[model samples]
Target: MKEKLYTLIIICFTMLLTASCGADHYMKKGEKYLALGEYYDAAAEFKTAYNKTSPKDKDKRGERAKKLAGCYDRINSTQKAIAAYRNTIRYNKADIETHLSFARVLMKNGSYKEAAKEFQLVLDSLPDNELAKTGLLSAQTAQAEKEAGSRYIVKKMDVFNSRRADYSPMLFGDEYDQLYFTSTRNEAEGDELSGITGTKAGDIFVSQKDDKGKWGKPEAIVSGLNTEFDEGACCFTPDQSQMYLTQCTTDPNYPRYATIVTSNRSDAAWGKASALEITRDTLSSYAHPAVSPDGQWLYFTSDMPGGKGGYDIWRVRLTSNGLGGVENLGEPVNTPGNEMFPTFRPNGDLYFSSDGHKGLGGLDIYIAKVDKRTKKFVLEHPGYPLNSYGDDFGMTFEGPHNRGYFSSNRGDGRGWDHIYSFEKPEVIQTVKGWVYEMDGYELPDALVYMIGSDGTNLKLNVKGDGSFTQVISPNVDYMMLATCKGFLNHKEELRVKPVTESEEYVLQFPLASIRVPVLIDNIFYDFDKYSLRPESTKALDELIKLLNENPNVTIELSAHCDYKGSAEYNKTLSQKRAEAVVNYLIEHGIAKDRLSPVGYGKEKPKTIRKKLTEKYPWLKEGDVLTEEFIKKLDKDKQEICNQLNRRTEFIVLRITYGMFDENGNLKNPPKAKEQDNGGSEDDGFVIEM
Candidate 1:
């Protein structure tokens, strides 16, 4: 009986040891996940450890609670984080980071007074703690802002969002009627839950706006892009002919790293996807692909080596020769925090979200505009209602306006991002233009100069059928000039009406040939006095604009006289008239070297073979107008012939202005300038198992 009793005691002791060891295993696993930034799993494991801790071991229980609170905070569960932190403080009240973290959660939950007290407690111990000081200030500011009411009315997009997470929206189609986004809903193709989010692997989903202007239910994006593996986060080429999507494949032996893949769109359906050859590293994650507006660069977020930290934005050139080496966007853009979901406005400005930058809290959306002087990005936060103490990102503009849809986890404690529509209520406008030769052929290499009455100047170079687009502000007057080698400069002007509605204007620039003598019409001298007529101001101004537009071109401005004038006298008078025009141009901004005056003095006769001959059948080609010829015509016809013979014209003297190299490429394309605000840094993937 004694032997049996001893054996039973031994069995009970073995069972107790097993339970204790299991708790230790949970604690260790939780620590590993916390280090990996997998807060969801870490919280689960830490909660188990907390429940397993002996009631007498208050220190061990407090440690477990503290770790659980951190995980909750990282995952955006403010209430749960607050509860866990309170439990931790009940035992360990002097932990500085814990107190600061508790204050942060309180601030996020809108408990400003409570948060300030907690932050003060930390400051008492660590008086120089910047995070604590900042937390206190942020909490006070948030409380005040909340009371003042928000200008933006943020409502969750119910029709497009699910109980699960949906984010990274991209607008496509010319009308922007199709919206593509990433989701981890239960209906996703993958059956397994992700270790990161504890949800089904992400899949691409699309929502369409109906004719009634209402968003319909979102459906899984077709085109076989979503397989049994994880696939999400996509961007389309400007033409919408192709897509680059992020895909994460699973392996039992390793952590999944996201890779970017391309798929062609044919007849409104997507073709099979093929992985892009961005890098050979299998361990680094590449996601959040954004194609540059010019279609020459593919930008993505990666956790590769050489990154500032976490995930950094990198871009690779997509050339005809294939993908070029990756470049990292360094410094202010990337910190020791994750920067993702980069998108561009129709203009060249870049918008992205980052947690590294100082903000209210979490990830805040920022606009990065190129600084002209520094040749770097100047970052700006939109402030207040457009941002919150939540993960706000994945912004997409509807055309060129300040209103659009974005993803955010504002009110949800579960960190479930949902689509939200935002509007700035300000008027926005855009201008698009096409440059073509006089013969109707597209000028692919045309240079376009853009200037706004509001002190905006930019140069745009076209590639395809000479076309360019620009964003404009409301109530501004804009002028654009298009020029190409062997083609006369063409000018266009537009005034954007100041209205609350968004507007787009299409302008056409039909450039004439410089190789052919292009006439400067309506350029009449004042009664042979060699002074320009008041009626000629429009034509002369256009000439000045052309000279300014084509900085590299030198033009010989030739003046001609009617055959009735004395040959020697007319030559001297025409020379004076040509020189007058050149002087006027110099007084305005044209360089003197670019303009040269010459006198033709009836040396070049008018050729009226086609259009003029069709109107006046009596006129013939290569006809030189003289006193005898004018006398043969009627009074009306005689005056018309004389007027046609006496005009100003310009022909190409040299097409190789300093504007282009010997190979015909632009030598001085528009340099990066800052209007106001705003690497191939890649990483090697490490197996994080």
Candidate 2:
């Protein structure tokens, strides 16, 4: 019996030891949770440990302070976190982690200069600490940037958590008074599951600002277009008559992927949803459609083949019928990580969310320029308050106000999803243009189209003045086309796209008319030859008409060669060519200057060609040719290279200007002026032959 009692004592001792170890384990876990930013559970565990600790254990006080400070920081109580951190620093001067944490909290609170000093203290003690160095650099950078002009000041407003809401906010209307966003708020009338979120499905919601500039309560968009499944990321046609939204099936087993769906607004009521055939694909998912203000191109995100990474942004030409084939956005805009939720503001600036590039965390919002010349994207990240260590995405500007909406999952109040407003940087601007007729008149009711080289089409309609304008996006080639009934369509090829403020481009078209004679300005020929040059036929056909019109009028034929060979040889060659032209004209029954033939070789020069081979000190003369040089040139060059030097020309030297009587006999003859020699007084004509 005594042995059994001893055994019972040992068992109780082991049980007490195990309970103590369990409590310590939980305390350690609480500390780890604080580090990982999971504050709610950490607070509970730390509270239990603090209550269990003995009153004399002074270390417990410091532990409680540190844990509570972390909880406050996670909840965005910056002031309280600062005080707690200060207390911990005072009590535990040797804890480097506490000092670093305090500095980080200070930085978050906008006390950047103070944060820099704290980081410097840590770095001085541990010179090779990478985190300390990084913290110091960031603090210094923030301090410096504060001195620069604040082009954008990001302000985090109230955290929105309307019962399971998922945000993808966008701005609509010229004044930005209305905001449209995608959400899965339980209040949605349909109350369906969103397959993408694995929760209550998404529906379009709208919020409006009151006269006082305060946002009104969000209300579901009660249109025929709102579906039970996901519907988000919408863009308006230039006329605002049609709305395009990205729709994804709620069922994962569904074969069809995300697609661009359209709805027509007629008489203020939305019509049934219709998928854009050109943009939809069974094999690929397409979402986040952004239409330019003019509706020329449709920019969106896709996971289609050939993309750089997950869901790279792409574009397609928008036609009256639908969207064109998709083209990938390459380079800096797309990375090996997921890029989604692209939006184009009225001013041509692009905002999107990306996990492909370096960012604060998860999916951070990024801005980039569309380089029209290089056909590539260049990305820029908004630091600090504009971005946080959470998924920040789906941004849209509110016109020139510099205010915008974006979604984030930062701070501890709400779980991982909500919409927030921030101020946009002012470095970006918008481009605008118009469409007109060839007669310089506007074409009302005409459609203006702009297509990115990558196949994104933005569409717009012509106003009463036949004018159309759209914010020009950066980094994409624009193929602009203007179309209207009863007018010949016109197209302008813009190789490099611009991101400048309000660029104006005019496109004109001529009304279709009967085909008329148009001059051909381009032609080429061989040297001193009577035969038709390869390109000469392109122009000769137009000339044939004048011959057919005035058969009675005669024209003089002349040919002159540039100086390059012997004068006698050149003269003879020119004369033969001139005579050959005269013979051909007579055969065609065209009275040349009543057909006079002349050849002024070597005597008359069209252009003075300097003798570069000649000696002249301090002068480096370039090659020059006069009529005199034609005869001195080598046979090969004289016959070929001198093609520009030798060519056929004509002058209307005479015409039978008389009217015929009723009996077909000339009743009166017009007086004629005597023709001068085929030479200008400045340069006497001499037929070498």
Candidate 3:
């Protein structure tokens, strides 16, 4: 019996050894496939190994997870890649590589906040990881900036051509017209040798919109400028008389060079191309030329030996004679990653494409507005949607249109690029003016609203500029209203009908000081705290400025609350809040005797709730207020009746002098005090309670 048992154990041991050997063999094969960039096949092998291996083998599980994550990333399964990396981390908590990999996938998925957390974890685990540290800092900065309301809204133009690889958009002089780019669906001028398999040879194509507002079919400019080799990344001078295009020599013998070639517009057609004698070398390649609006400067990308990375944008003076010496754009603009496709707008804004900069993926288009006086550029990313986790390049603006054109291989499209025209928002007659008390100082954060003749109400917050502009449909009359807490609202009727194509209409507002019987809204305070919240300070400051401007205007500070607590207690709380505002004004150098505090607790209901019996004469008493009834009421009325109706307000008691000029026209008043409260003429109004 003992011999028989021993035989069974030996057979079992042999079977176990065979299974282990098979799993190890498949894992090694999977690694080899992964190294060869055969990710699909690698995934299959890895799956086989994973299925055969025991879960107890932590080291093997970690290796399998890493391989699977790599394969998933290659296949563009970002969620799955993230999951695999997380699994690897779970199996081996100390793996900084897995954490970094996870963070990258998170960033690609737009989970920046979470990605930043993972990056931070990697830094904590491996302090010496320079790449991870840089990525973490970038992620953190982006997350913070986004939270701070610094965001770019990109609208994708639906216009596309299914047959072509349209890309590299360049704007011209006209606001609605653009020139953009492609290398597919068009024939080459000379020999049509395909650079990449299955597509026609690259050639620069031009499409124009006629006066009738219709985009004509794109046609390859038949000028001798286009060669059999790749030709693209074209930019036109402001006058549209000259063009700079990238000319690449694909012949293997001269495979390493691309030159910027220029052509003149003669007899309404581009002439023969002449290569600029800038950099002449066998090893260097130059492409993607961008000419400034004034035609005084030209920027192009090159992979020359002295570059900081794969390709860097180099600029040269386009003098009266010809092209001059080249200079690198340097540092923040050029990184260790590939940067190309530089273009400049009429406003001297530099727009370019970069893959080296930390971005969603592929190449992202970045803008650097040139400070002409300082001779410096400030680099910034064109935020999401305008940019995606795909190649977005060649942005062009037509004139100063809010809407422009750019090229992208994003959204629901074939894997090729397409030219899209961005619609610059209609040029509305922006009524840019400031709000001020009878005093000459500007009012900041004043809530400004424009009620159009068509009853369209558009609201805008007055910026520190003390100015507000809201884009509205032009050729209409608008009633502009400005309001701030503790100040009487001001109104002006403007008939802004722009007869020209574009114009600016300015309207100034001089608000009357709140004296006797004025209502103040939006007096917010902290939860369970009598102290004013930061937002409340904004409203209260406005009141202080109004008082300081009109020193003779005495006011009464009032507080109110909805029916929530005992009426007596609510009244006391409200009165305290009102007194707090009065004290704040007094502390800010306003006469303490100029303000009076009062409280109204559930006594004045803004929204009168009609009992069901009153609405339907036969209804019974004691019926509760239904949600439908509440919603039927105006939002402001409902808010004024909610339980959270805690507020502070001001009412002008007396104005020593009436606010208007002798002709009844509003006159700018003088400053009451010269105290420097760190308050500028542009400081917005503040009311805190």
Candidate 3 lDDT over 1-689, as tens digits, reads: 99999999999788777877998899888777665445656777787887676777788887788888878665545666777787787778436767876776666566777878888988887886654665676566655544543234465543436465667866543333545565667454555534332356567776687888777766777867676666788888755678888876544322336787889988878887888777666567778888775466788898887778779989888777776778998977887667888876545678899866766655677888866577677788766666665567887765434557788766433346766655433543555668875433567758776678765655555644466655545667777778776566666667766555666667777676553233454677776456666676776776776676566677778887766678898787777888888887888888887888887765543332233245544323533333444456677645533642454656678765446678976565654646575332333332211
Candidate with better TM-score, 1 vs 2: 1
**Best by the lDDT measure:** 1
Candidate 3 C-alpha RMSD relative to the actual structure: 25.2
Model 2, range 560-609, lDDT digits (tens) per residue?
A: 76666889987887777667656655666564446677776655543322
Of the two candidates 1 and 2, the one with more favorable lDDT, higher being better, is: 1
Q: TM-score for every candidate vs. truth?
A: 0.64, 0.44, 0.46
Ranking by lDDT: 1, 3, 2
RMSD of each: 12.1, 24.2, 25.2
> Where is model 2 poorest over a 10-residue stretch in terms of lDDT?
680-689
Tell me the spans in candidate 1 whose CA falls farther than 4 Å from its real position.
1-18, 25-42, 91-103, 114-133, 148-153, 272-285, 296-299, 302-338, 372-376, 432-469, 473-491, 495-504, 508-689
Clashes of each: 20, 53, 20
Candidate 3 wrong stretches, greater than 4 Å: 1-134, 137-160, 172-178, 186-198, 252-254, 372-374, 412-414, 423-689
